[model samples]
Target: MNKILLSVLLIFCGTSVFSQDTLLTILEEELEREFKVLSKAEVPVYYMDYRVEDETALTITSSFGSLMDESNARMRVLQPTLRVGNYKLDNTRELANYYGGGYFGANQAQYLPINNNSKAIKQVLWRVTDFAYNNAKERFQEVKNSDIKNEIDDFSKEKPTKYYEPPALGSLDESYWKNTAKKLSAQFLGDSKIISGTVTISGSFSRKYFVSSEGASVVQNFNFIQVFVSGEVVNEDGEIASLYNSYTASNEKGLPSFDTLMAETKSLVENLQKLKEAPFAEPYTGPAILHPRVSAVFFHEIFGHRIEGHRLKSEQDGQTFKEKVGSQILPDFISIYSDPTLKNVEGIELSGNYKVDDQGIESRRVEIVKNGKLQNFLMSRSPIEQFSNSNGHGRSQIGADPVARQSNLIIETTSNISDDKLRKQLIEECKKQNKPYGYYFEDVTGGFTQTSRYATNAFNIMPTLVYRVYADGRPDELVKGVDLIGTPLAMFAEIMQAGKSIDVFNGICGAESGNIPVSAVAPAILVRRIETQKKPIVDIKAEEPILASPLLNKKN
Candidate 1:
């Protein structure tokens, strides 16, 4: 979900020569300078924090067996937060600022380069510190003008944590990424029915430095390499359909072999071809079986987002689980939790694991549900009633303000049956419900949910590969065009069985703050009843290829 291409914005000064300078040294030097100046203000800065990301990245893309683009560069992201008022009535959670964005802080998209002289870097820090302070003051005044019953404090106690990260997995130069992209993209060539195919490989190594007025200092580093392959085809009904296959790892050695990537690309092309001829599904509401991958996304979209602590305080949020903490929100055998400290599970590296959160709090495990009962919420420094401490889930996308977000969400169940048993249960439910067939959600592209009171408290998960399982035990048939839609509470209660094998889905999840990487691990589930809706009609007219890909002058 994060498209990190090299930024070409004009530079006012020379670029940062990263290897020559230590990022921590620059951060400590600036934090001292900015704090000294801001300490003398009339209102005085009660709290201040500086966050920087020094990243080097490479991106390579190819389409239809030819190179499309390639870029490599470095980026340093800057975030500074200065709170002027007390913790309860700070310069945050205030009315919108002049820019119609949050008043808590101004996210600086670009900052001074580390290669610049000390004086130049200090000047940039001073300006950013000043900007944060002014916004804080405005928000404080607005808080006094407003009247809302706020039961929870504005901020929780400051956390003191110190951690120096290990060096990232070794960085590979540009040649490696370029060659990989070429081979992966070539798999789509010569496939007659595939309209377009593309492959992209992106890799990055980055270190984050953070310091706070509350005596917190942290340095964390990480590296990642991702290969994404996708194909697109238009159906006879003038609808666009697409499929994706992605692999992620912390280093080159962890990535799947070249042969595996080629096979995956071929599978994606074959699936898209099948979808092109699959019959469109009618809107239906009945029993369904979610494959492990589908179940992972289902729980993420319909459940994980609702229990973030900050959402409970917002009047705009639905607060579906707020008062249900002591009650059962799912079947008696099910439970859910989120843990950011887990680096890997069963040898698979997780993209969501982080040593420390953006707010300098060490990552921890949070049990949101225990044995089907609601337990707690994912928390940041911002607390809610009965939960006044951070559980290390406060996260952001570099420049944006931090909020409570899910990390590595894990869904567990004690009543786990084998996949064969789960499908048997699905067929039984379909027959009992008097439906002709039940759906098997095999693979999903992505999905979204709404937890606001202003909109329906529901979710819609987009499915790319779906099938119909007959009640009489006939062979499953591929189907096209249906969205998994449901209300959260109802859907949770409908689940009756789970599979033994677990699967994981990883991507960058976007919320009020920004997009942050997340993962969901779950077993397949059998729901007695589930709902789906027909895809909206597209306006594209059916026709022959405008200019058939002149490959060997073959015409469709």
Candidate 2:
């Protein structure tokens, strides 16, 4: 009978004209029928999420000769959740703590079981609904009737919105995938010889369907494409050093051009070769200039993570800036903002733009810091005491709960100092401090930070290309084996100046739940006083006897 009703609704709506209203109507009718069976127990809240993903990948790997691997796959996932908190215990402790603390309990479980068959996709909705209903009932039965009534009354305060419908999946095909792969590969290969390198191109198109018992339904689609190129050179000491570049786009046209990527790859290879003989430096602290890319890492690891709303809620967190709000945390010339609605910056497309967040709320721009003063915190539905509404910053991986997460972080500076001036200033500062040389961080890999109160609140900014600028006006020397480390508050206070040029760093960030693509943009920055620690050196001995093969041939 349910199948018959769904089929009838589909036929009535037609494939091309199936709007959000039509989908919601169908879901409402189905939910009403299911609710009749739960007359003995009241349903407090329920939600459903359905997602379909189509993926294609092409990979080239080199052990001796390059081997190609390609795959095309699609998958659909369905999740339904129901909450019944109305069942209350007569115990005073249970009545006092309503949200998961009392005798009234809340539980959630995934309805979709692991399956290899095609029929698994079709069973998602039915299975999830059944599971949620059953799970809610079991919990409701444990509580007293009076407590159940009180919990239901509390849950009734907020009403869910109308159904939401996402944009349609226009078209997708193999040709589109192949062409994109070809373009990305050609860009990275350029005129260089086929040295030891690998290229991987992958893309996904995801469609989502969401429904709730409170008359809310939504369907949306998201598209993603990524291309990655990696190459490595082993030093005489058997230290394997590698470089990688990745490009992500919502559509094919937004990706970097072939020429641009080829140039980057060539440059990466050259840098790796240079690093083969680079010497490590002893730990020191004086003056340092962080290039735009390095500055992005500094900001993301140091500042961005510290501002998440969940961290503020945890008493264990340092809450570095909680009391410092309305005070100057950064230089007057610096301004930072995070906006999910921004599709581009300085004509470059941003990967963080999205119409709605994971929790079905519209995305908005969050002014994290305005002209050096702390402004607001990224918020999810979990409101802190001082913050009441959601700014739609909540995000998470599929099947994970959402929390306040960063989007596109833009660090703006009003200073007009150039790269040369920044270096000159660093040298002057080194002279004043009676130091032999200062540091310049030209490039970086990503970094991490610990914001909890248990440990010293500090961050380590890893540098790929670091230099020592002598106070005697001698040539800048390339050095390795030092990481930029400092306390956030002290570092912020020591920010001496910023440069005019800006650079963008794009990559994936891994946290509690999973990894997500994030971008950071900033200009070169100068800090008066910073510290570094010696990176632990590996004791691997160099492999003996260079191969006499032509693959070892060096360029003139």
Q: Which ranges of candidate 1 are over 4 A from the true structure?
A: 1-21, 94-104, 107-109, 552-556
- Writing each residue's lDDT as its tens digit, candidate 2 over 393-502 gives 76765655556788788999889799889988998999999999999898887788888777889898878778888999898888766778998988898899999998
lDDT for position 299 in model 1: 93
TM-score, every prediction:
0.92, 0.79
Q: How far out, in Å, is residue 456 in model 2?
A: 3.3
Cα error, residue 314 of model 1, in Å, equals 0.8
Work out how many backbone clashes candidate 2 has: 6
Clash pairs (backbone) in predicted model 1: none
Worst 10 residues of 2 by lDDT: 1-10
State how far residue 155 of model 2 sits from its true place (Å): 10
RMSD of 2: 7.7
